[model samples]
Target: MTRLILPLLAAAMLALPASAQQAPTTPALNLQQNMLLRCSAAFALGQRLQQAGAPEAAGWPPLAAGGREFFVRSSAQLMDEAQLSREQIVTLLTRASQDLAREGQLARVMPVCLQVAGIR
Candidate 1:
């Protein structure tokens, strides 16, 4: 399970930028920003799960790392693709952090994370 999930996580990270680049303009899904937000939530949730000693936490480190990298890379892509300034990215991230914090536990956020990463 660990082996399988790790590869899926890595592949999701790699695929994110390409998928964002190819996303149609004016689509309902804001893929780039949504990915960043979901990954941020996932990172936070992973930390909490690890602290609680959940068995599923075994994959948290890698998922969190990949999510972080994906967040950084995707935010850059958002800058170029959406013409958003660095200030805007920071603001958006801050908002995402706050919103996710209010959104409760790992169970609530995990599905969004998986969806954003295109893992499910």
Candidate 2:
């Protein structure tokens, strides 16, 4: 047992520096940047759908859905890395939803969030 213990500890110690020396991953974009990108992408996607001739109502849904998925993903990341609160994330998502809803692709952008989520 004593022999096994020393070897294990020695191995662990040796591994630590190598692990540390491995450059950490470049930091991910923060919540705001991610949200901006997601919202913009959603808008672009929505515009494409509109141009493809989807009804205004139907087109909005997919964009909103895509946007929400991104929001959820961003919230999880913010919580994990930055310790942001759920409320803050919610507020951010809400504001983003409103902003995206107002884009020119939308005609009567009422309650677009559910529509986006409902998209496959």
Candidate 3:
């Protein structure tokens, strides 16, 4: 029993590193779906605000909020979408990962998209 246990433990130890070294098998989902979802939410919010007789600027809050969410979600989705095309994926992943390191970039862009969407 002791001899068997030792070999089993050794095998398990060896296998662990090999498994860890393997590239991730599962691909992540992309940002497009998330962006669409967020946009939908923002649009809905804007409609509600308008119906409630809130100022035009009221939509800005939710729109801006959604824009930021969309950007982040889109960035992640872009990373995932890259899987469909390996070369493009590498470039996008690198860019997206790098951009993520910069603080407030998403927030900055959010208002612009929201503005374009007529949120304010």
In lDDT terms, which candidate is top? 1
Q: How do all the candidates rank in terms of TM-score, highest first?
A: 1, 2, 3
1 against 2, candidate with superior lDDT: 1
lDDT (10s digit) by residue, model 3, range 3-120: 2322343454445555442443434444654344334334433444444666653434544344445444544555555443333333333334345325644444445456544544
Tell me, what's the RMSD of every candidate? 11.2, 18.3, 16.3
Using TM-score as the measure, the top candidate is 1
Q: Against the correct fold, how does model 3 do in TM-score?
A: 0.28
Which residue ranges in model 3 land beyond 4 Å of their true spot? 1-28, 56-120
CA lDDT, candidate 2, residue 67: 49
Model 1: per-residue Cα lDDT over 17-54, one tens digit each? 56443432332327656666556545655655565677
State each model's CA lDDT, in order.
0.55, 0.46, 0.42
Model 2: per-residue Cα lDDT over 8-105, one tens digit each: 43454445555432432334556555544344334544545544676764634444345445544645776677565444444344344456556662
Clashing pairs in 2: 61-115, 61-116, 64-116, 65-116, 65-117
The estimated TM-scores of all candidates read: 0.51, 0.36, 0.28
State each candidate's clash count.
Answer: 0, 5, 2
